[model samples]
Target chain A: MALGGDARVGEVVESSSTGFVSQSYRLYGAPHLGALVRTGGPCPAYGVVHEVATRGIDPSRRPTARGEGEASEEDVYRSNPQLEHLLRTDFRAVIVGHASEGGTLYHLPPSPPPIYAFVHVCVADELSAFSASTDCLRLLAGSGIAALEEVVAAFLRHAVAAQPDPQAFLAGAGRQLAALIPGDFRTVESILLRAAP
Target chain B: MTYRESSGRYLGVVVGGSMTRGVDVRLSPDCPVEEMALGQHVVIQGQSRRFYGVITDIALEWSDDSIRANPPDTSNPLIAGVVATSAAYAMLRVLPMLAIEGEFAMLDGPAPARTVPPHFAPVRLASEEDVQVVFGAEDSRHFWVGNPLDMETRVCLDLEEFVTRSNGVFGKSGTGKSFLTRILLAGILQKSAAVNLVFDMESEYGWMGTSEGTGMVKGIKQLFPSRVGVFSLDEDHSRRRGVSPDYLLRVGYNQIEPGDIDLLRENLGLSEVAADAAYSLARHYGQERWVRSFLDVSGPEMRELAADLNVNERALSTLHNRLSRFRRYDFMTERESDESVEEILRYLDRGIHVVLEFGRHRHDLSAYMLVANLLTRRIHERYVRRKEEAMGDASREPRPLVITIEEAHRFLSREVASQTTFGNIAREMRKYNVTLLVVDQRPSGIDEEVMSQLGTKLVCLLDNERDVDAVTAGTYGARELRSVLSRLDSKQQSLVFGHSVPIPVVLRVRDYGTAESYRELGFLEASEMRRQMERDADDLFGGRD
Candidate 1:
């Protein structure tokens, strides 16, 4: 219902029960990949930014290289203000869990974030409560999402800093992953290596 | 990281298990698996009850087989911590033996665990209270025998149940079998109404004996001198050891019989036919004078005697040669009466334990076999007749007797077990209120039937495969106990199970030989005994000179 000024990051451009797409107000302003983010609704849905992309808003027109004639990439963007309007940055966050009445529930929410709802990057305390159990990895483990291991690894890497004991958090996530991942431990171990501080 | 904590000894949770096959406990990630040793007790808190279990085995486990094929790189501290906690972990194989419910547990004692705890039930290292609940506390009727391995709580034996049936103490040589036997003997004397008749082959049960670590340890007699008496086969040797026995045991010529020679068949190196010939010799010379009359026959006299009995002369000569070795035992006499057996019986009649020391004849196998068999046969005969008489009148019931014998395999071997008195005592159990405490190093040499008849057995480390099999055969939970028995430390540790203890336990047999231990064993020092005497006199008479 309410949020901090710095917490507001973007508006929900696309919505689905499993995931949502958010377009940043400023170019390249989308939260870091795997950072946990929330959306506005009666029952707000939490998500992990699994994929990020910067491309032309209109699918028909593809932008050619304008950097070759400029002194630097910044000079091209300054020379053509239309370039900023034409291109956009969008992040696809898989709905890992949702906020509940008593506390955060590390499971899928009843409804997806509303279309055009404001997307807010979660603060440290929110990240702490969500990462405590690391139970959301169950969704990413078999979500049929691409680069699933990398997404889980990246989530652990960013979430550990919010934990009281970052090392213990990483280890807790590994164990949670051990129970969540249905395959060999090597898969879980490889992911852990990527998240090691 | 605080996955679970129950009184801070929490080790794991019951992941999976069965009533018959025990349970698999997934250890908490923070718990060090190496610290969980075999034979240590664990208590599991169930939904409505608690289960007590012993750690029979431990294993390294993974969520998958990849841990074995492609182990995690533990090079980094974070990776190492994660791998240790999650990727690769430990599992404890616990055998839940006893179950206790809330108020019922305090009243009825723990019952056998009939079922495994539910999934994810917390398992903690058994506290002193849990161990005490299962084993019971030391009191007037129970004796503190030892501590459970690595635990301070005393493991007590119900002396009432202990002396009710035949029991055994077994271990390889130098495993403290004799020392443990001394402890049990002292317990029986102090706690129970049963009287002991120990055939002290090494003279270790009377006065004082030498120990591997502590020289000159006090014997059962020294611990309870008023209740215990030493009867020596070699009077001079006993005197040299500073033990003036109550009686000097001298086996008369008339006391020796055919069956006594039969028990010594292996030790005397006599053939079956040669040993059997003694029966005919006894029938000829009369049972009273067979050993002496047979030994007295000369070169031609022996042959002529053998022919007269229709026996092979060479076989008779072999018997004579082996039988003549008994002459070197100066304890042998030509007296007309059986003095030693009567003396032992008289002492036992007075409710006093008699440890018949072999003295110098301790190393002589023939002497030990001859004296132990001869004495037990006469004593058992008297007990059977008295028991029969007592059957007609319960008031005439005699005090229960526990006959302790070392090198029991010789007398209870498969060949001679049917005939020897010791085997009969073991098999007959407590029918005549006469049981046995068989102490031996090689249990495999004993008759299988007698071993099965044993009610309680305390076994130390036995590396011999056949020996282990012999002790554990036909036992409940033998497969699981085999693991516990295999892991016992070589000395001062024993696996005690059966009639006396509620559940099987591995005990770190309490310290002995120290002055402090003597006090713990209820031994009053000379000054203390004097003060006790004064206190008793004060209670009896006035507090005056």
Candidate 2:
């Protein structure tokens, strides 16, 4: 069962086609070619819904040439059992994206499909999930974006410590890495609030 | 790193690929190395988790317990397999620090490799303080310095080492026994101003010319003159013409008793007795020339006069024969004179170390007797002079002269005791500081008393057990001394025991680097001989033509 639109935990839904399956778990975002692999099934099936309107909404904002070129085939390979284990576990969320500023992607050994990455976001409040996930996703892209958030959050909390601005610090570093590939940001608001200084 | 103390010893953790860091364990001595079975890897220690180190000392260790406990009935696969496995690993590892890790790291880095430290440090047996105390403050007597087995030992000997008394060097031929002997001699010559007289019968020391050419020849020849003195036994006849009749009689004849005079009379002819009576009468008349003047007369006429007196011709002839040398001396002494003889005697009295080089001459007993007689006489005169001076309440400086006789066993016989005057001189000369450096291949052949009196002895590599035992018998420190002598390799090891050197040291002599000099000398002599041969050949052919 799957949901076509965004979701709230309490909402109940049904799949377009189902036979004794669990309640529809709604998950949709930009770059709409997303996937949902049912891990525990006898013959686990991986469904990739390549939405026809995805390219039209964000065609110009594709991943950089380097990101598309140097990416490993493992990024596309999905492991259902591993995904099922993480999804059914106590872990709030798992992110299989760029780990630090240099843009090295981190995939757990039981990887999920490439289209919808695993982003782990453990936030106190669910309302701020979207903003926090976006910031955390950006952080996974580069040192510059992550460092900037650290500075902004530090100021907001009146934790204005004697430290340089992160973006300026990254610029001062001179060298740059290729841009990061995009990932789902459903829990960004909560991630951003939790990661605030 | 975590460490634990076990059996009162600390054991360190095994970090990375290294051995236990803080362990202090060594191989136990109780277990004999020979008993270790093959193919058995004994666990020495476990440093970290899952990291174990083992040592397989032998192959038999890997055999089945039952098979190992019982003797093998036959050559079986079970034993063979274990032996093969054990051979693969037998290295002992202590710690990473002790391992060759540092050397390998240095090799991997950017630099050339060199040497590792030696297991033993070179040191001499004696020290400088010992040297100062034993040899006195006078630096001249430090003969053992630079005389040890190596350069480091030389430095130590030079700075240290002491000798309380004189020393001796003995060895077999070509075993560097002579070379080491020379080293001690050379060292003495360098350190002390004390006089040394070397009797180089083999002509070895004569080559101590200048260290100009190269190799062993690299020495200061200015130590003495190149051509010191040469006494050819072959030329003794011509030499005798210059000595006085009294000296000739002393060497050629021994004193006779009155009983021999009666025997001489009985053997003489009546006519010979008459001739001797007339000659005696002329000598009584103070006509020394007239005694021999009758020899110009006819033999028959002289016999007629002798017949009238009833003198025996042969007995008279013997007296005339005896008087002939006196007449010959009278004629010869008038021209050459005895002043030079007196002068030589005086010069000898002043104590000059003279070399009597009898070059390439086969032994001549007469020449030996003459030279020996002269030397003995001079020495005796000096001894008397010293005795007289002491008795007369006069004081004089002591003269300690050592006479070295190379190949001495040739002249001084062990079987001949003090029979000859020379033999007696050899026996008694020790008291007058007249020490004899008796060198020979056969030390056993020399007079035992002479050998025994020589307080210092240097024994080089001896091929003959008898010779080694004989030389060793007279030495102190017999255990180390005996071992050193028996173990000496030909031309390498030398056993030096004496008052000159402290204890007996087996030394490997350094080459004097005089090979080039010797080669040059050899080459020049060979070319000269060749040229002379060619000239002789040409001369012979031209004369035939």
Q: What is the C-alpha lDDT of each candidate?
A: 0.85, 0.35
The local lDDT score (0 to 100) that residue B136 gets in candidate 2 is 32
Clashes of each: 0, 83
| Collision pairs in model 1 | none
- RMSD of model 1 against the true structure: 3.0
Docking class of 2: incorrect
Best by lDDT: 1
- What digit string (tens of lDDT, one per residue) describes model 1 on residues A152-179? 8888888887889987787777778877
Interface DockQ per candidate: 0.61, 0.01
Candidate 1 lDDT, tens digit per residue, B1-545?
Answer: 11122352888889997877789999998899878888888989998788888888899977677677776777877667877877578999888888887645756788888888999999999888777778888898888999987789999999888887899999999998988998898888878649999998888888898788888899988888899888888888988888898887787878888888888888888898899899999999898888888888998898789889998889999999998887888988885476667788889889999999888888888888888888888889988999898875867877899999898888889998988888889999888889999999899999999999999999998888899999999876777888888888988999998888978889999888999988877799999999999999999997985
Stretches of candidate 1 off by over 4 Å are: B1-8
Candidate 1, residue B32: the lDDT equals 90
